[model samples]
Target: MRTFEVPTRDQVSPEAQAIFDNLKKQVGMVPNLYATIGQSANALSSFLAFQGAQAKGTFNAKEREAVYLAVSQINGCDYCQAAHTALGKMNGFTEEETISLRKGESDNARLDAIVKLAQDITENRGRASEETVEAFFAQGFDNAALIDLIALVADKTLANYVHNLTQIAIDFPVAQPIEEPALV
Candidate 1:
């Protein structure tokens, strides 16, 4: 159960109504995350703003979903992990790839590094190591990519933690849990 009242579909603010409507039409449905966020116009607006900001990247939806799945897995957010796993499949990521992301080991060191660094930065409470930064750079990511990843992290963290706190119903089905990796 959510701590706050989730706006009834009819109760959504005009601004959030438009955003959620657009998302529903395009994505087939307003996600439960968005539904819960619809309770707060500012939070839903912030989520959309972050999405807009991250849209300039060279990373395709698959790569982005990989990052989301990896971080969600590490952070143990069932809502995000399940949601992104479905979206990742829509983006053409294989089940194996999704599972790999959940385990933070998709065979590409670059992505693994991104996932690890993102999780580490989040888990360490924002204390990222120099080596982590260098490793990210070595993976062909530039300063802009770093910034974009930070934006993604912030975006997902808000929704993930919200869902965790709320025990938000999974709008998507349960994805099989991937192995919780030994501390990397």
Candidate 2:
């Protein structure tokens, strides 16, 4: 397996260097995934634009983190699972709650809806069941939030796939194993 090189700021184009500078300021350092993305000058900036736009959407931090956790776990991306696990904690999820969310279950009704929807979409390859959609809305998510959810799915899917393909070093606290609940 060929390992993807995580480019340093000097190795990328000037445009990507600027983005790396901004990321360093924003996140304290450019994460390995983002650094790998800087290998494509245009892609890094475009991804930043898309990601920044989504941050302005209706989903709160916790909700957005749930989407990331569910999608990443379903995709089996270790990098993202680790990254979002840390982020999930910062967004107020307990370590146990983070593990539950990663497994597509949540004790909170609203969060369960979000996790199930995200998991269904990822597991089913972008086609969540109608029941999941209805439950998501019944849980008080509007059409805009639905759109945001889809956007988040797209975003996290891209990140998950990137890490899956690159097999990058995990940059955050390691996530625990995802325990599947026993089927009754």
Candidate 3:
């Protein structure tokens, strides 16, 4: 199989180059995943907009990272697993806690609800069980929060599928392997 090389800034459209520059200025470097997405003329911008809009939602940084970790784990996206593990830690999740989140649980009941719902959504392809939806709301999430969760799942799903299809080189610290659950 051929490797998909991440395109350099100069190799992409000027609009993508600007996004790349902003990524470098903010994050210190263009991560391989972001650079790879920049290969599309507008995908990178759309992705950034979606990601940026998530912060305005009800979930905090920790909760959002939990969503990322849970979806990445369910999809078995090694690239995202590694990336979100580091991001999870930065957002106050311990390594052990991050692993637990990957397994669709958390010590905190509220967060566990979030992770469980995210896992269900991914595993069921958006047909999350009514109980799971109820549990999510019982954890203090409103309808708007649920919508944001779904949006986050959709955003992360795009990244998960991209990495799965491309088998992109992971730029984050290596995540330990876990057996992927069989798809239903």
lDDT order of candidates, top first: 3, 2, 1
Which residue segments of model 2 deviate by more than 4 Å? 181-184
Candidate 2 residue lDDT tens string, 1-184? 8867777899999999999999999889999999988889898888889888999997888989988999898888889989999999999999999988988888999999988998888788878889999999999889998888889999999889889999878778889886674110
Candidate 1, residue 177: CA error in Å?
Answer: 1.5
**What is candidate 3's local distance difference test score?**
0.89
Against the unseen true structure, what C-alpha lDDT does each candidate score? 0.78, 0.88, 0.89
Q: Give the alpha carbon lDDT tens digit for every residue of 1-184 in model 3.
A: 8778889889999999999999999999999899999998599999999899998898899999999988998888989999999999999889888888888888899998988998899899889999999998898889998889999999899999989988878999987665555222
Question: Candidate 2 lDDT (Cα, whole model)?
Answer: 0.88
Best by lDDT: 3
Candidate 3 positional error at 81, Å: 0.4
C-alpha lDDT of candidate 1 relative to the true structure:
0.78
Better of 1 and 2 by lDDT: 2
